[model samples]
Target: MSLAIKPGKADLHWLLGAMLLAMALHFSHFPLWTSALIVLFMAWRLLLQWRQWAMPRLWLLLPITLLGVAGIYLQYRTLFGRDASVALLALMLSLKLMESSTRRDYVILIFAGYFLTVTAFLFDQSLWVGGYLLLPVFGLTACLVGISYPHGVLSNRLRSRLSLTLLLQAAPLMLMLFLLFPRIPGPLWGVPQDAYRAMSGLNDHMQPGDISELSLSGAVAFRVQFQGEIPAQRQLYWRGPVLWQFDGRGWHMAGNDHAVEKLEGLGEAVSYTMTLEPHNRRWLLMLDVPHILPAGTFLTSERQVLAPMPVRTRMRYNGSSHTQYHLAAGLGSRELARALQLPPGGNPRSRALAMAWQRELQTPERIINAALTMFRSQGFFYTLTPPQLGDDAIDDFLFSSKRGFCEHYASSFAYLMRAAGIPARIVTGYQGGETNPVGQYLIVRQSDAHAWVEVWLASRGWVRLDPTAAVAPSRVDSGINTALTDNTLLPILARQDHAWLRKLYLNWDAVNNGWNQWVLGYNQQRQLELLSRITGTTANWQQLMLWLTGSLLLMALLLCALLFRRKRMPIDPAQALYLRYLAKLSRRGIQAGAGEGPLSIQQRAGKLLPQHEAEIARITRLYLALRYGPHAEPHAEPHAERKTMAELRSLIERLDC
Candidate 1:
């Protein structure tokens, strides 16, 4: 007993499985080499168990453990933040497996497994990720239960049932606490900024390849659930960042837009509730030409939605937009100059062509038409992988390659309008979105990212135009899948193209949308709304506390009643006699266990009191006969029971500790 006993074999297996599942949660967070290191360590631990090898000695484990710590520190350059701490936790878990032997070690490993599950949540709080982590949580609990059993004795089915039973029993208490907890606004203050880097979103810059690169991803940018008719696919122009300055290479939002001008409505306004996913950016995308802004957001001069701060979590807000609206009927000298300014010398051929058209056409509208006609008739093809342009990008695209995506089309078109003596700028945002029929909501993905041109005229301050739409209108209607003749550039989900698969995608996305709305998007606003709904009036802290306290008291009373009822259930006659015998022994200075049977008590008393051996032995034999040694008739054991009772009373009165 000097050395701590090794954990049960079944417990080791369960613990190993739980650790691997926890590791899987972080697969995307770590580099391939780090993930490989974790997997190798896990496999080595499993091999040790299979070979029945002894736990690694402290001399070997300590250095390896230190090496893991050093590796994590070097990889992250610090061990003090969210990502580094999670990596350290993962490393410790793998190393701890190598030295796990005693029940205390097993307990520590299981708790580490729980901590790892929570770390996964620290990065992603989506419904599926949360649901997926529950498996490891159940496994860790079952492993703890299995550790209490003899080696190799616990069954998987029994372990699963017991762990699940425990979770089910604890669910009510968990839910009660969740509902009664204080509702706090804003983020929890611990979400890692690094964890959100891989998720792509629109920035304030629009380079040649920016939109094309975004089109490669199919992840949902946001979802729109309309109160009335959903906008047409071709009309679903959700505006985001606006770029006015072109520095010969890219379009950016710097040094152009100064003060935001309020856009006036000319038509009916469309109302919708937008569920925007966290992209760590401030722009709150809205349907093209919004007249009224959602709460907590303002309209930029360039007609872009701007939030007060970066969005770090899922958010839902109500907004009203105008599908057909006139913005800026007139522009100031400063605004006009900003729109018309261009780089000194790039795309000379494109600039020359635009000037020639303007001189010949004699009007802005005609010039626009002429430019559109050229793109439509001239053998210019629409593609994603446009050839790399040189210094004269517009010249190469217009006169040579003649192939590009939305950024190419938008950038070149804006340059043409400016060269034609017309004021114009580049507007970057998402275009069309697929409508999920199941939930009747719009799913706008990254692949829908687009850039269009905005031109100015004396009659109309600014006009929206998509030269890419003129060349490939299907991109606006049927989406990028049908727009590009070469299907290889489509996103993975769009490439599948099977009806059932599409249905499955939409259905699953609908389920996720529901989870996002009710769970991830449940903020302080929603909490107050729920309370108001429940009480049929506006709710306050006093009402919330009263309700919470009353519910908690009711739960406590029910639990107490159940426990008391169980305690009052009947006990067997032999057990009753044994309890009395133990009580009598305690009074005489000798005592049996609280749960000991007459036979076991007799054996212990006989060793200490051989003078009463005859009485003790007789009582033990009669009790065994009456309790377990059965008779055929109902009253056959009555005489034996009477003898056992008399003998037990005589033996107990004479026993001593």
Candidate 2:
């Protein structure tokens, strides 16, 4: 009999489901226009699949591809870097979906989906991102299984279930590999310069509205877990880059020509560790004055820490920061001149006011106090929406508008101090962070980008003074979100008043803190520390590799045994019963042939043993029924066949040769 073969609609539904999921994830990383193009392409492809419209011609696809490439180049200024390349890959995947008519095309698309999964990790490795990425991977695996095995009744569901099970089983092994894997010193390949240039964490220089833009983003900058004691919120000064030289509007890094020569001459050290997130910048943030550093890191005479290479990924480093350390004890005239330099023109009103204040005070300390008092007493508002300043921003901010973020107040304060001959510079970095109670760690977000002023006293070195803090003390004690109650400036968290949600948010932060510390923050220093922990102080790479290989081999052996144990021996209960029946019939002269059917064997047996003919017929009928039935009833007892088989065996024994 010939079986009819027809394609099922279920396959169509499965393919569409996979395509829709892939499209949703791919669109998230593209521009608005690119996303619109993908939506149009998907609708067009669906129409073609439904026979409502024809597929686009080959000639049409060429121009579309060229247009997409051009669009990516235009959007990112170059068809390079992590963002641009990912966008291009997403576009190609979408285009491939339009022409995916064959099983091979589907397979290629599934592999592309896996590549996209890894690419997403390159962008962000947070726990939340990892959780979101699992969906597409699962969908793609289902599509792969459905296409490969179309006829099996439970193939698609079983394949997906088994795949997830296998992945879960392998997770422990993956973690083991991740922990024990040797870390290379540098990038394996030359990364693009603009790979992740969104300018996260902190910037080296501060403009009028630089910190304002940074405060809008809710991205996390870094997480710190104190070893000995957590510093008070007021004392938490995470110093980043120091901006000394200033033009009319913006501030830049000071020239290092007058940098101090040695750090050993500084005061006592206060040791601490920091896990810095990727900022695409080389400046490292420590407590205050870092003395010791990892192998590739160096310290400048200005007491700023520098990494040998620009940090493109999460980095963890240990340092000894002495908050009381005196830097550049004997400040040279050249160095003092550099710190005193200011923009010649702008802020003329503020300059004249400073000169007048200098005449009254005649001391740097009193002048600094006066400026702080002015910020506090002048009704200056600390707001996200600050009024625009003219060429003389400081004059306008101090006299007319009197509304700005931390950078504005800081820039003006530093300029006024310098005008009074007090050596001052602008320090930019995150201020207060939300302390995660669950993890006992401080989680610093990008919203904490703050700029404060530091005035150099002859006896006190560079004494920190935050004029913004004097105006808005809540900003330094609590987070910026709490300080700025404007609903327009706060993120989604500000919309809700749920206590449970707040706890959930804190718990989620704790999980991300662990992920960043162990996965993204894993480095050469961490690797050596891990090795030493696992194999004592004398651990080496050769011994670690040997242990790793042995453990992997043992795991492989165990997994093989579990998977193949059921199929190793082919003697199941039904087959064993059939073999026994064949042996019983062979005792008589009528023996079953190798390829003979049950009916044929029964006919041959009837001729040899006429008395047992009925018995043999009953056994043959039941045997054929069980073997050829649409569904086998293994649990049902074969009563008649069992009696007949016994009688047949007796008759065969009576006719022994």
Candidate 3:
């Protein structure tokens, strides 16, 4: 009952556990030193409790706290933003545990644990993280219950059961708010700017090893669900940034001119919905020759789709693409100049070969075919681990090493095209995808990263060509796993050897896809659509607010009814008879004292009324035996206790008051 009372041992243990669980969620994101300090502080607090030591004095605590703050600032360069703030919160909570002795401190720690648990979502909102957070939430709720008791002596089983019951009771209210609350346009919370860094995907620059290095990662780039039949692996060329500016060693994206694209679909367009994971880039990797762009996106002069803002979160958009299309057969003079621009001088051998091909073939089509034939017949090896090249990288790959990944082949082929007077550029994007039969969708991973060449001809415009396909046809037909003879570098999910593991992964990914589409992807539009379907007409924000308010009030009333419902205490037959006997004595002005035992009351009654002494003594003896004697023991026969109670009741009924 006293709020200022020191917390009991059980309460302290619960507080420590709740803090541990909350901090565990962030350990992976925290710096190593920060995580180490958190663990050290928690261990010190536990030792203090174990040894029954006093709290650390202010002089001892103040300096350590300052040092911790300085360490955090040094690690993050500032004591602000999402990373630093979360680290400071976690460290301070552990420090708070050192002095958490009172019920007030216990309550503060429990609430702080709740806040810390919610912060984990700011970094990751995946289904696994969301499900794991319930653990800390339950621990904090149980700790709250522990602090409410004066003695804090509740058994762990009982406490856990109570916590589960509370969560279950709150589930309806949570669901109601989630469904009916007015939906917002952006994320539920405002994340810091630093939250978008370190995301994995293709970048603007593509060196010889850029795509090869990215091919080693198994992280999902995007998932596509087709409105019609899924496209073949070779046709699944998801186009990203087009690199027109090639340095001697690397290729970079050109300046965004925002030129209107001229495209004509030659075949039936394949409609599909794309759920792209954030790579902190503006480019939306749509399939090749996308005629219908998603809303809020536009096609560049080179047919690269661009969003207005960098995607900092998982997003879903709808677009249709034609496998066969004519894209920008005609280019402006400026575009033409930029496309043909390359490093002034390098790869002399490569340039000489291209010139010879130009003189011999004299046309773009024949020259391109000659290059492909040479790659196919010249013992060119397609490998993930290509030897490092020197300054003349293109000449080295073509003349000496002849071993490279897709980027190497594409870069060399594009250079040869430019040297031969054909406008050519490198297109970097994903090449192939694996279909998840469970979800009936295509999952394109970073392992499918690829580079190909696009050459412009006089009449046909820019034509898509993949020199890697010429060297290793399986690279496009199957996947990178099948294309590489040595596939040990690939992630287990990307390889085909572990059939059972891949199946399990597919099942899990399918569940995650559903969670992404129906849970995380639920936005303002989804809310409006769902409401319109539920009602006969379209529901606006005002109607949503009204429904939300009404649902909340109704939920409150239901909770109140459940909480305040009356409960009847079971009556004991022996106690009932004893109380009746006492009432009879009270009527005769011979009431027993508050603390009087049955024997004492019987003796007093006998002294006051000698005629009823024998009956009174017998009744008292039978009642005592039935309620508290050997017959009352838990192991005693229930029938015996009932028989004794019946005898006592009969004797009391026979006695006169």
Candidate 4:
């Protein structure tokens, strides 16, 4: 317990294991050099022990510690943020092992390892990560057991069992706290600004290959659970940002919301709940023409659902959207101008063709059909790896290159519409999702990222037109995989060739979804709902606290009762081993009489079983030492009794009557 008390060899070994496991958990977050440095420090401490080398001097250790701190500061620009602070702790903890010659130092390292284990949750609260961290936790607990059993009365295997038992015993209390404790409003893993690192998703602007680039990643963007049957692939247009202004090469948003003159739902609304991954953006991707918005979210003038705050964490929200709807019947002059705006003096050939269509077909509807006809009949190819475009990207796709992803077709089509006097804008969002048969939920990944065009019409108000569909109808009807011939760029999960692999992935995802919903997603509102279901009424904070206290007290009383009802004296392990040996010998007609010593029994048994005489003698000697020698004394060497008992048990197992 005191600083002067050095940890025994067993304790040191367990401490080393605990430290290494804890540091390995954060390898992904640490810089390569930082990871290497910590590894070196750990290796040095291990060598110092294994080779019996002297510990580094204070003067040398001080400089190394300062250098590590300086390195962390240089890597992160400050030694205070989440990453930097964790890096510092890992370095110091590993360095601490070098001078950990006392029990107090070893204890500090074990506690620090536990702290580091908890930090892993801050980065990822996934079910697998949470489960994996239990290894390091178990290792640290074993270190505590080693320290507690300094005399080594318990073997290593026994200590491991005790450590696991301790963890199992606390599971009920942990569950109680998780269920009844007051819940926080936001994400449990939310931390400082530095912790909200940039995530990959749709940006507000679309360059030539923005959507195509995003399509390469198969990471889940959001998941949808519907009240009834899931929507068809072609109808599942999860709307995101709408871009109105085009600055020559790329499409950008209008950077403001406009008031819709009129809005109406044309069909039955589809009720669904969305679990969106953090994308650090204000836009909440939802189905087209949402009628019921979740709290803290509103529909913009362009019909894009916007959250009040950027989604910096996983969010679950209930939403209802009409697949068919009358969106924005009228547009203000500013909105109209913005929608039709195009860059000056570019793609004259494309502009000329659009004017010809405008002259030939005087209606917006006719012009739209003409554009679709051109894309369908032209040698336009749908692909993930689009060739580079010139400054006039629209013209390059329409007349020159004629090969690009959804962004290319949509951008050129929108440009053609504006030239033909139709107010068309680009709408970028996910186009389709794969239904997880296990959970019966739709998982929309980034590979489903798509771009289409929306043009205003006098009769229909605003109509959605996907030019990519004209070139690659399979994209809308099936998925991105079917739309492209060279599906090599697509992620394996996004492909359809491996049905068995897909099913396996879906089964695992279903389990993860449950973990997310019931564990990480357990917030204040969920807690209250659960309480109402349990108590048949809404339980407030006071009632919850009372229930928690009563349950804890009841558990304590039960434990006390079990403790007091136990036998006064526990059975000796050495005696148990000897009893087993005697029982085996009795099968050979050799039984020990009352008050017979092990020496007399060994002499008689050895003569009768000459073939196993050596084994019988060894077992007897071990049993005698464990039961009657110095090891039998209460204050004798702690390991002597355990070692002898183990040897006797081993010999007894191999003995022939």
lDDT of each: 0.81, 0.74, 0.88, 0.86
Worst-scoring 10-residue span by lDDT in model 4: 146-155
Runs in model 2 with CA error above 4 Å? 1-16, 43-60, 63-67, 70-77, 150-154, 165-177, 186-193, 261-270, 481-488, 492-498, 563-610, 630-657
User: How do the residues 176-274 of candidate 3 rate in per-residue lDDT, one tens digit apiece?
Assistant: 988888777755644675777768999998998888899899999999999978988899999998898988889999887857757888979999999
**Residue 240 local lDDT, model 2:** 84
Q: Model 2 misses residue 70 by how many Å?
A: 4.4
Error of 2 at 471 (Å): 2.1
Compose the digit string of candidate 1's lDDT tens values, residues 146-218. Answer: 7766545578899889899878867777777667656787776345546565557898998899999999988
TM-score top scorer: 3
* lDDT assessment of candidate 4: 0.86
| CA error at residue 237 for candidate 4, angstroms | 0.3
Worst 10 residues of 3 by lDDT: 184-193
Error of 2 at 298 (Å): 1.6
- Could you give candidate 4's per-residue lDDT for residues 1-657 as a string of tens digits? 345576666677777787788778789999999999998988888888888888898999999999999999999998876788889999998888888887677777888899988888777778999888888899899888777665544567988999999898788889989998898776566667577774789999999889988999999999999999998889999889989888988898886656743668886999999999998899998898778889878777777889888888788999998888777777788888888898789989999999999999999888888889988997888888878998777787888888999999898999999999999998999998999988999999999999998999977788899999999999999999988898988999999888888989999999999998888778777888888898998879988888889888987887678657867676688778788888988998998999998889989998998999999888877877877889988899888667777778888887767
Q: Give the top-scoring candidate (lDDT).
A: 3
Each candidate's number of clashing pairs is: 3, 0, 0, 0
TM-score (all chains, Cα) for each model: 0.85, 0.84, 0.90, 0.87
Q: On a 0 to 100 scale, what is the lDDT of residue 52 in model 1?
A: 82
Give per-residue CA lDDT, model 2, range 1-657, as digits (tens).
112222233444565565556556556667889888777876677777788455577899989999999999999988888778878887887788676776676777778877766676665567877787777767766666666665543356686796588677778688778777777776432257565766576776788888998888877777777777777776677778989888888898976665553433345456666778778788887775566775677776676778887877777777766656555546778878988998677787888999998999998888988998998887998998898888887888899999899999999999999888888888888787777789887777787778888788887677778998888888888667666758467554432356698689989878777787787667666777777887777667786687778778887898788777876567744445566667877776567777988888888888887877876776666556555553255665677546544554454345432
lDDT-best of 2 and 4: 4
